[model samples]
Target chain A: MKTEKGQPILNIRNLNIWYGDKGILSSLSFEVQEKQVTAFIGPANCGKSTLVRCFNRLNDFTPNFKFTGEILFKGSSLYAEQDATTVRKQIGMVFRRPTLFRGSIHENVAYAARISNVSRTSELNAIVEKNLRRTGLWNEVEGILDETPVQLSTGQQQLLCVARALAAEPEVLIFDEPCGELDPIETVKIETLMRELANDCTLIFATNKRRQAARVSDVAGFLYGGELIEFGATEKIFTNPQDSRTEQYVTGRMG
Target chain B: MNSLMSRPNPKQKFALQSIALLTLGVVSLLVWNVLKKTYLSDVQVSSVARVSDPVPNLLGDIYFFLSISFLGVLLGITCAFYLEEWLPETNWVRCLIEGQVSILSGVPSLLYGLLVVTVFLPYSGAFQRTQGFPPAGDLNTASLQVSSFQGDTTLFYIAVLTFVLLVVPRVIKATQEALRSVPIPMRESAYALGANRWQVLTKHVVPLSLPRVIAGACRAMSCALAVSALFIGIYISGYTIQPGRMSGRFALFLGAALVLSIFSSFLSQRYPLASTRHT
Candidate 1:
């Protein structure tokens, strides 16, 4: 695995998160390098999603959500006097289930642009086309850019979500089991797209599937009971894990 | 399949037949009542008064405006969800906002009108005074005539304000649910891409939740419309229905209602998740 030696794009320190007084993650810490895929592998109910949400402040929406942590983006404390909108603009996200706006395929892709005041008709069209093609959705949706997203298949919708995320020109991309709902073929397509996206943007993906992390990640972190059980290169974590929990999780004995 | 089909008991068949006949009779009686009220009733009284048409029409306009305003309130609530994302540390602020929304939502529209009459109308008067207008000439003073504008028609403004407050919680609750439905992975992905918080919400969260937000707005609007209609019915009941003047007002009101209902129906059909979907 080729690890970039420089200032990390994301620095998380002693992050602890809770929902209604029930701790989900405790004292978690890690660094995500720029332009590389960092996959988080864990079992269900682990703090993988909670840890990822800290980076963008997405967990604040929960009524009783609370956290004690420090998240730094490019060396600036993300939680200090900074706006979430500015942070969000710099990072984009894709979900397991594709969420498409109730509009044309073009409109869904162009949504970020519209909000950011990118209203130039020609520029907007160019962006929609470029990102759609990048995510491998252009060919299927190109012929019907004006058609409603509800008309597309599940795979296409997920691809469209990728295109939508890319439209914002973010420097980091996060995926929460982006292929959980996809079949094998669709999963392969998404994984390929993730690799392509990683060349230009940092990728932080959280998944319960160890095989998936092994397939796409350069650096992998195993989370268990809200702790970072192990962190190393994908090969090392899966084949020669230092911790017993990590071994059990990756070998399918536990998790 | 043939073995499973046991012959029906005579008593059971008779009971089913009687129940079916009773249901049919009830439905036919209700339908007859509707027909009689709509078409067969005495036309002379209806023609001379023409009360129902104008009242419902004018009330409809009030309903339409109230509904649109309710939509705006819902949109505001959706925007509020993203705003809350920025204030993660301020649990008190979040609680306060929620409390305000709840309190306002629980207050009845009529009570809202009363409050508005007490607070906003006086404030508007004060504002007018500060702008160099003579203190609204005292109704008791013989020198000034109290025009309709100066009268208690402030009820309209109060009704709208109250309706907005009433509908906001419903909108917010619906919007919050929709935003919550979006998986956290999607949000994390946006953050990982180096997108800022606002960018993630505006770009990803808002769009994904919009259909649900709109649906909430539709529901809020319908409720506001119904309340406004009821208010108008109660308030306007005693107004002397002058043929010429009342007819115009009534026509305008009905026209507004028709347009709003049509628009609401269209929105619902076009965006079924947020509105009603035509099947």
Candidate 2:
């Protein structure tokens, strides 16, 4: 497996998060290697989603949501006196269920770039085309760019969402259960796309599916009960896990 | 009773059916009464007429209704945007404002008119003083004299203010409902793409909620037109309609209601969720 070795893009130190006194993430300390797929594998409600939402400041919208942590993005603290919008611009996210805006397929792909102040029609078209091509959706949607995405299949919509996310040219992309709603074929496509995306962008793939985490990630962190039980190279974590909990989880004995 | 297809208790079922029928009957009678007054009644032409033709007067009334409703809807959209988007839903200020809107929505139109007469007209007296016009000679009599240029503008603005007070709460309620109907995930999607609050609203939420808002505005406008006519009949009868021309005034109100209802229904049918198709 190819790995991009460099300084870690994100460093989380003694992070604690809560939503209205219900603790979500507890003392998470880890580093995400730059330009590599880092998977956070956990069961449902294990704070994987919340942790990824933190990277983009998406959790700020949650009422009574608070976090005490130092998360460094390229050595700068993410929680410092900086605009959340600027942080989000650097860290894009793809959700579990596909969400498309109320516009044409072309418009959906161009939304991010447009919001970034790219207004020229040709420029938006190029960005949309490039991202769509990157996600392997260009051929399928080329003829019907003006059509609403409502008619697209679930898999197509998910691909369109990935394409939309890529349009902004984000540095780090987080996929929070992106394949939760896909069939096997669509799942394979998404997994392959994640591999291709890892070539250029740092990825944080959070999933309940352990096998998927093994398949896609260079580094894997096993989160159980809102705690990072183990973290290391994917191969070592699966074959020779340091923690008993990690052993039970990877071997399917426990969740 | 043991059978799955067994009928309900006969006495209870009969009572429910009778109540439903009675409600239907009452609603039908009310609708019929209004329709008769609107179409069948003779339009009495007054001798000392400012505008003899009821058509022009009807058109003028419609213009007034549209102006007031448009302003109300615009302000309501702004308030809804602030409440739903800018402010956190759990914020005390948002809750307080929402509660106030609910209370205002329930308040009767007469009370708004009373507010204009007691509070607003007296305040207009301040503006009159600043303009070097003699103080409104008599508050009550000056308010009634809507024909004079100065009094007419003041009264028009006061009427607008009153109708806006009446219409705004309804618009705010409708707009808020429209904004709420937009899925949270859609907004999160936009935010995830690095779009700020204003961009997310303009590009996503507003477009999604527009059809519903326009539909709501149509309903509010029709209600405003009909209710304002009734309000005028009660408060300033000498302004637009003579004492004996109640039937003609009723016709104008009913006409506006009918046209606006059709328009509202047309809007609802034409663009219902067309822009908001989710896969």
lDDT of 1 by residue, B45-139 (tens): 21122223344445645554655564656465755675445545334454455444544455466544433333344444422423222223331
In candidate 2, which residue pairs clash? none
Please write out the lDDT profile of model 2 over residues B112-222, one tens digit for every residue: 654443346545643443332223344333443332323345556667777888888888888888988999899999999999988888888889999988888777777
- Candidate 1's residue-wise lDDT over A88-158, tens digit each? 76767787788766568998888778777889999999999999989988888878999898988788888
**Whose TM-score is greatest here?**
2
Cα error of candidate 2 at position B61, Å: 0.8
Q: What CAPRI class is candidate 2?
A: acceptable
What is the alpha-carbon interface RMSD for each candidate?
7.4, 3.6
Q: Write the per-residue lDDT of candidate 2 for residues A1-255, one digit (tens) a residue.
A: 133565698999999998777898899999999888999998888899989999999988887789998999888999895589988888999999999888799999999888888899999999999999999999999999999998999999999999999988889999999999999899999999999998899999999999999999999999989999999999999999999999999999997
Q: Taking candidate 2, what TM-score does its chain B reach relative to the real chain B?
A: 0.55
